[model samples]
Target: MARMKKNFITSLFDTKGKSQDTEEGLTKIISDFFSSIFSSSNPSELDILKASKGIKSRMTGIMSEALGSQYSAEEVKDAIFGLSPTKAPGPDGFHAIFFQKAWG
Candidate 1:
């Protein structure tokens, strides 16, 4: 049997160049760093409806209806075939070539 080794942050340096090894000190240092990054000054509020009042959509009713319609089998097959075969595998661990060859 093989033994599993665990790794963790043993120590961290604070902004003042002091090493923090205690749990509380490490937590405080990390929290302060993230807080400094995420905190915002002079935040502005926007009214979305007022901002979008003058913006006009370019799509026509026919175009909208076509977009909402279901795709045909030929279209789906074409899309699969259009993908590059040498590309990296998807999240399911299968490449585009696999699908193209299986269903081509």
Candidate 2:
């Protein structure tokens, strides 16, 4: 009985440790993905969050210049990904308001 209990606890710890590692790996992937998105012509997360407050933010400016004046980031994202705005979860659990512009 004692050995069985020890084995059970060890197995549980192993499972927990594996899950934690997986979660960390996923987080890193998410960070890397964001980095790639902003690697060229686009600003980083800090820049996006900074521009979240205005109608004429960097993202908006890009959209207006390329996609047209009425283009919004949400629309651009949807068009690119073929999904609704909600499909792309923002980085760090917060949305970065994007104004459309073509730095690309």
Candidate 3:
């Protein structure tokens, strides 16, 4: 006989010091936590330009042109199909096989 598998969050507290244990409450708490982390704090455009100026570019004219060049549909398909089908899924929860199979 297999042992019972127990997986769950017993409780979670929100910023208000309130305890949340229900599914909806827990989902809201978790969603809010991640949202806060990814939410961007608007920065000034001048600040961005100033910071970018400090960075040095190593790319040559030829390299820059090659990187900026547009790819043909056949090239794009080849690049995607070149990836190993059995590799792990990407951050988007999709494996290369997904793209290969979905390619039209």
Instruction: Give lDDT tens digits, candidate 1, residues 1-104.
Output: 12333456779999999999999999999999999898765444555566777999999999999999999999999898999986999899999989988994
Instruction: Write down the TM-score for model 2.
Output: 0.20
Candidate 2: regions farther than 4 A off = 1-21, 41-104
- Top-lDDT candidate index: 3
**In candidate 1, which residue ranges exceed 4 Å CA deviation?**
1-46
Worst lDDT run of 10 residues, candidate 1, spans 1-10
Per-prediction TM-score, please? Answer: 0.54, 0.20, 0.49
Model 2 lowest lDDT segment of ten:
94-103
- 63: Cα error in model 2, Å: 27
**What C-alpha lDDT do the candidate models reach, one value each?**
0.88, 0.53, 0.89
Tens digit of lDDT per residue, candidate 2, span 37-87? 868775488886777757554566666678655778767666645534344
Arrange candidates, best lDDT first: 3, 1, 2
